[model samples]
Target: MFASSRKSSLFSSLFQTPHIICRGSSRNRVISGSDIAASSKVSAQWTRLGLSEKKPQEQKPAYATSDQRMASLSELKEIFRKADAVCFDVDSTVIKEEGIDELAKFCGVGDAVAEMTRRAMGGSLTFRAALTERLALIRPTREQVQALITEHPPRLTEGIKELVHKLHQRNIQVFLISGGFHSIVEHVATQLDIPLTNIYANRLKFYFNGEYAGFDETQLTAESGGKGKVIGLLKEKYGFRKIVMVGDGATDMEACPPADGFIGFGGNVTRQQVKEKAKWYITDFEELLRELDSDSIKMNHNDIFY
Candidate 1:
């Protein structure tokens, strides 16, 4: 009977494909049954969706040829001349990975959150609804999220920090708005030397006993189109004559109508909606700097925001 139960459990585990437990011997580590289940579930999900069902490759894409350049330096400079503040999306925009989704992985709810993220991003579900559902599933402790910071250091895309620095030097206000949690975004803001007050992202709520409670939906970014609303707010609040938004997702593309100029970053994941609609598309931040004529805008670190 016990053997039969074990077999059934194993089968269900495989179907659900939850988490993996790793064990090591003096010789080497061996994958356990739970690992198999998780792997199987992942495979099943991807297969059902027609996704590749494989880990993403780390290599970068080849640069576009000169003929493929969307706009010349002269054209970009004209736009830059009017822009006063630059707003950016955090995940897959300035950084290579999605922050909250990655945090969900650490909490053992990556698959579930990823599914919601997809629906929300693809315009099938409301951003807030998907976000609320995903956050509810994790119930992650603050410490667990902090541990993720240790496990997965937010990787800023090539030339991102330098671009932010340059923008700061040029007296432009740099803002990071993300659908990711504040706990994680705070670290990024600090590392980039951007003011914490200027960072707009989600903040998680906790119980008195340090248990995971829920998220502050008010501050958290709503699904994809929420970015456009944020752009509107910033424009109204700052009265900035020109606004530029940089991102690489469907949501970021929505900002085009609200923003004065939209710059798409293909350095990370490039969505067709964003690529097609963006005012300018560049693979990396360096391309933007080059297009903007970096030499003239370069200023001292402290010269920014003057």
Candidate 2:
């Protein structure tokens, strides 16, 4: 059934003129350069960090399959031509490691926490439950959290910096929305020059003595489908006409509706479900840049930041 649906979708895409309906609006419009230029820009409110030197030998994940890769790339080119706002999931999407897993490793519970994380991301376990169990095992300290930050700064996924820079130059609003902790993701946002206010993720709490207390359970991303809720909020509050989400998790797939498009990323980690369900999937960010350039969607440096 899925294969038949995909074939039908590909066939239709070949013949149909591309159009994206702006939700909460009356008219349907073809995606245009001018439309992208008019998208909203929101100020970010997170703390900035100094940029780190790029790793010269960062590892890349293997592609799930060659045939799936080709199809997804072809579809992604069309999607990119229409997107005005792109939200990136931090762990394994924009960054190489899962933040919590790294913390668990630091606390000497690496194997256990990693297995739980696998289950959570694979959709076999509820995210909140896995997180609760893992956190209890690790019980990270304030100093340990800082140590992880210092020793293992979130490594940027290949081509992510360039991708965000290009998107910004095109006057597109780029956001980093993660289920990861703010303490870690903040540094990543700073490195990418993404506004702190635009980042949405779980926040960690600490005692007055700087000991690890607990996470704020109230944040939307603390539970399942939180990514979708955040996407919906972005649409409702900002009035963005076209939004795209790029990630490597089941949660990222869940945001497809409010996002308008979902691009599964496998540069760091490849989940089979994300690869199968995403409208487009890719293992390299450069593929996205290439697609944009091929479609004449490239923006000059001077034309950006309007």
Scored by TM-score, the top model is 2
Question: Candidate 1, 289: how far from true, in Å?
Answer: 1.6
| Model 1 weakest 10-residue run by lDDT | 1-10
lDDT of each: 0.69, 0.73
State, as a TM-score between 0 and 1, how close model 1 is to the true structure.
Answer: 0.69
| Alpha-carbon TM-score of each model against the true structure | 0.69, 0.71
lDDT of 1 by residue, 147-200 (tens): 566556677778889888878877888888887776666666776889877777
lDDT of 2 by residue, 1-306 (tens): 001111122121122232334557578868887666553211111113344434478553231112322225545555566677899999888988888888888789999887876676566767778777778788877667766776667778779999898788667899888988877777788889998888899877666576666776777889889998888788777777677888998889877666667888999878888888776779999988776665553344546422
Worst 10 residues of 2 by lDDT: 1-10
Clashing pairs in 2: 44-195, 44-196, 44-197, 45-196, 45-197, 46-196
Off by over 4 Å in 1: 1-77, 294-306
The list of candidate 2 runs beyond 4 A from truth reads: 1-76, 119-124, 297-306
